[model samples]
Target chain A: MLVEKSAAELSELLSGGEVSAVEIAREYLDRIESINPSINAYITVDGERALEEAAESDGRRAKGEALSAFDGVPVAIKDNICTKGLRTTCGSLALGDFVPSYDATAYRKLREQGFVTLGKTNMDEFAMGSTTETSHFGVTRNPHNTDRVPGGSSGGSAAAVSALLAPLALGSDTGGSIRQPASFCGVVGIKPTYGRVSRFGLVSFASSLDQIGVFGRSVDDTALMLGAISGGDSADSTSIERPVDFAPGGLDGEVRGMVIGLPGEYFHGVAPCVKDAVMKVAGELEKRGAKIEPISLKYTEYAIPIFYLIATAEASSNLARYDGIAYGYRPSGAESLSELYLRARSESFGKEVKRRIILGTYALSSGYYDAYYLKALKGRTLVIDDFNKAFDKVDCILSPVATGTAFAIGEKVNDPLAMYISDLLTISANLAAIPGMSVPIGLDEAGLPIGLQIMAGHFEEKKILNCAKAIESFVEPLRPPL
Target chain B: MSTMDEKQILRVARLARLDLSEQEMSEYARQLNDILAYVRKIEEMETANVRPTDHIVDLHNVFREDRVQSSPGAEALRAIAPRFEDGHVVVPIIIEGQE
Candidate 1:
């Protein structure tokens, strides 16, 4: 029943006096109270604060003072984003008790727009894993199937939105963190062009690749939320200063003259069912007056190896700041400085975190830097070049977000290599620093969701959104599992 | 292929500030070698004349105005510390006379 209402629909209902903000918040809170215990989607819920904000929003509306369209709309934020006075744990025990003193630029912008904060959602520890299973706080289960993991890092945000606990949620994607989870949970998630949204509040996973994205039930709703949160902020050095137009007017399903590319390499290793669903979407777009062409991104095969080296190198450098000296948990009974760091990190970080740190340190180590780190950086350039070439021929690239549907919770966790490959189709976008989104297309035989990823050139989010909206209109929004 | 040895694992662990037990060191060496072997596949690709990309976007020198800005003061910094004394976070002494 909740599948019928979009964020805009719910907002209109609240504004038109059909329902009050307090009642809306209560309904979602009630839903969370009923469903969250099973999915583990939300790590923290601010019921009291949310209701207080709702009451205030209701008062404003009563006096004929209207806020933004999203005003009084309930939303969830990923735990990695800093919210002043809230526990902004990146789902790691290290930052479990760390409370941010200042709001991340994105949080401030959302709050200023009058959106009610529901609470922080869970994620992979330090936003390091492809599956939410790496979260220090237990794994977030998929709303579709309890046995499978909601895809990760932003898995909690996607699952929460999918389960209707929140109308919209924020997630950060460094390498498929947002899109992969969106695919798994059967929702729409967009990883904006890097620098499109400010990264001030998001804990750094891989600086160049990390971008704050949003999860919503529909493309238009996702666009509305993205529009509100997208502009540049000086607080984050990497935030873009370009103008952004996220109006839902473009959702009219018109893609005339738009060239959508099907990269031959992206489809090479994909599962048959997944490839069938994605190609069906491409075929649908072609039917809607869009030109679909086969394009070659020759360097596509090198995406995963290049991604790990660069991301791990950046992660190693960025995570070095989490020493026990500053905030984050510090282990007791340390006899020496070395022991202090060793114990704190060992106890605080999960296996994936340690694995990445080791890999990064080794890559960036003096002797191997040229062979591994530097070469990977060059390979990254080739990947970007490949995208640039494709864009010259087409406005956007369409592919499956992942090679396959969501796997069971423990399916790939023990096999790190297999888990790493889960990000195959998505890593190139991050590597090339372009905008990419995962829009749910159809469910597999097991009833698991499969997402069709659409990517665009840097700062060309409008074009990507146009193409995505065109596809989304054809394949109706998926209904959530009860 | 560059094979990782115990000494190399200890050296890397030390640089990474990870104090791995003897058992963990051997285990990590095995896992790390497997991972590196996978990464080694990139060596076969011909990237002879490719340029290295440090960042995806061509942004350079994104400098802000040089002016003093307000940040969370020492109080906030102190709040983060597990223990503090004399306006400093207290940590175990590893290097003698450093504190």
Candidate 2:
């Protein structure tokens, strides 16, 4: 199946004349039609539009005008990222009809390189949940097991790639939204260092924490995509002014003398299978001449609380713009302006979103701000210091991506605290504003996928990608039995 | 950590511009209390002298040339609005008893 091939392999086929761009686009669209009903990974399938774009890609290739290596390749995008003329609901009814007039910079960059967008995939409402169950469209079931969830709010992107619906996809990570799902689905996901990518058309979940990233079947493919979408954008002032060079060829199979650190705090209380899976990957790298050492990130225990406080506060401020006065759904028969705003938000936002909004309002309210919000901000500094201290001893950090494999869909949906803890291992990287990724290492006892997280210091993406590539070469990649 | 009650939940919901039913207010009050109980552990840490880190990236004032540039036309902008009238967005009254 063309859809089963890695993005690099697909690029090779397109360039080698083994397949046409239109054929590749049609193959993925057809797969989405047949398989999407089971997993519900995608909310919209723009078959006609995709084919039209594919035809343009073919014309470009024939005229010797191909843009990049990923020209004519098909990719999926999370719904939170806007697309022109496409209904990009962020898995919520509030945006069920909100089509943007512009495209997200990440997707626009890929589109300029002639990448065919498969469709906008499903996600948690406003990218707020750990499990895809909160999605207004439906829960995106894990391809590995139908009864289990694909961790979210990038669950649909992860499941789409896992089920061979698309070779590559784009996802947004606020608090492990990207890596957790990628781990559950056994795909390679990269959340670049903050400011590495522009946030122009991405709907803000938590502005300080949210970053757009890529999910591919291999590190090489992810690196290629990152190179294409990275760099400064004039529209986004927060985007760093720097050269965007991924040097995809640098993912050589040599890890000799590379230092990998395993944080002692991350290993505590992780499921035995998940811990063992990471250890096995570490042992393989050790044989490849990479030194593995145990280090301390003592503030690891406070990461979850810090993340929740800061993230929810930012979410409250960012989400205040969705008052149905501009672009989203607005209810009728409001006697007053306040009533209209209240009804629109209360009616449209899902349970989790409302909960976060209320929490955020309380955190920022008078008298409580010092104890909750300010304290968390100071703790965030300590968290960053911990990472800085550890990076002095090692090139990258390795740990389990999640506590365990994909859980049954409703197991933790009703239990909010347990669901929040699921992001315990992955949020530290985000809070520290460093680059972190999940690469599939092996499967657990129940035939579910386990992922090892590779994290590096700020703007040290190349180092982590190299480490992930080495681990990929050493471990047998697990394919979901779809 | 302070326990949240229905009145507190309503206050926050009103501040957030969300209209919650009595049932939902009570439910949210319960959940928010539980979540805050967990989050209060950070207060125990001695962060007295540490400065708050708002953004992780070192930021400078980014400026662009103050030259006029064309943007997507108002027609395109109005097309995204749910209710557009006479070249402007139609909205409900902002102030009571104002025409």
Candidate 3:
């Protein structure tokens, strides 16, 4: 029961002394011990360090020196975010032994409030894939079905939170890494507006599109975690200063007289089950005094290709740093540095990673620059322009996070394009640099969870979270049959 | 229609500093060609004069005082290196005749 409570409920108990931080942490750790074996959600579960941190938090509370409401809550972090003295593999053998010397600004900010990290969750190698299957550690299964994949690069974080292994989790979204997995896992996940959260220590997959975000069972808890970790840091030039209080008015579900847009492109060719679930939620919102109207975002079809081209291009450049010299897995007995670089990367990098690097290298290559990379960049401008126009009229856009629910493992793994298309509805947010979130709406014919996506314009965290809270109120929260 | 043959995949792999086996070469070539065919869909959208967005933040040329900020020290930095010497990383020679 302690493990099932949300971070908000746990915080209240912590304040009331009904529970000690250590007991709550230990309960979750015990659950992780039992459940994580079947799910494979975490690559590293640091129980000793977590218990020690929880004890320190308890000590702070006894002395009346508690920093924030989330002081003693246990949380899981995606492996890509750098944790000092903790291994940050980014789900690749390339950095299997790499330990960060510095803490990511977001992680440091969480520590400011005494959040205990349960472990480093697994992910797609370098956040390249849509399913957690690409992780060198192992695939993270959907908590609802053992045969299904928890959607990824942030799949492990989402799965851990969904299975009650932790109250909350942090994830990075480079083209739907956080929101899609959050959908697949039947939890709430958010990708804040670009430059909203500092990316100083979060490992970069695609510099322009990557943003750090949070996952929770409820909207307010996710917003609270987002508020604590958000703010401008000089270390990350892209980070923009914004008001950190994201849960403005406590997500009171006040959508009266609000206009919600349902982009036609998102629902046009989607599966009946996914469309019905999203429309049912939208219809409920409309009945509650919000107006739902049709809107067209013509560039929606281009998101997958543009995202693939731009993201892989940035990834190729970002991952070039793992050359065996400055900390990463290096091979033995190399005759020259070229051989060393080749061997280190060739030996350690996964198939997806190499594919991305080659795609990126090719896109940015001399003859293809104007055609692939530059064309995607220009096409991205249209995508942004499309969202900019729509946000002027609608408070937020409602859509399905993916075309369908979580698919069986290995269903789309070998086919890279199919997996890339899994993120069509979500990738536009990253391209447009807008805030987007996924909250559980209902389920498909199969017993799996389906998530409804909410999107708002640039730096509109309050709008999106408020909308998510509204949806959260309408839908009866569904839990995985554990 | 867009495709990368084996020679092109190998060339790009070399540029990416990755050495591929014979199996990998053919595999990457096919996969890359398939992805490229999909990528070619972007060419369908014409943006003759549209400016490409490299970074979404509108702030250009953010300037701060050029102060020497403290960094994670040399010891901490060297600790994660696969092979290191006296305050230096050991790497195979990159230049000719250096070995």
lDDT tens digits, residues A184-282, model 1?
999999999988899997899899899998999988889888888887777876788777665787566578878899989889878899999988888
Chain B, candidate 2: TM-score:
0.86
lDDT per residue as tens, model 3, B5-60 = 88888889999999988988887777777778877888789799899987886778
Model 1 residue A454 distance off true place after TM-score fit, in angstroms:
0.4
- For model 2, how does the per-residue alpha-carbon lDDT over B1-99 read when each residue is reduced to its tens digit? 587788888888889999988777778777788898999889778898999997789887888778888897878868788788888888888877767
TM-score of 3: 0.98
For each candidate in turn, the TM-score is: 0.96, 0.98, 0.98
Pairs that clash in candidate 1: none
Steric clashes per prediction: 0, 0, 0
Write candidate 2's Cα lDDT for A390-420 as tens digits: 9999998999999889999899987788889
Which residue pairs collide in model 2, if any? none
lDDT at position A28, candidate 3: 92
- Best by the DockQ measure: 3
Off by over 4 Å in 1: A1-4, B85-88, B93-99
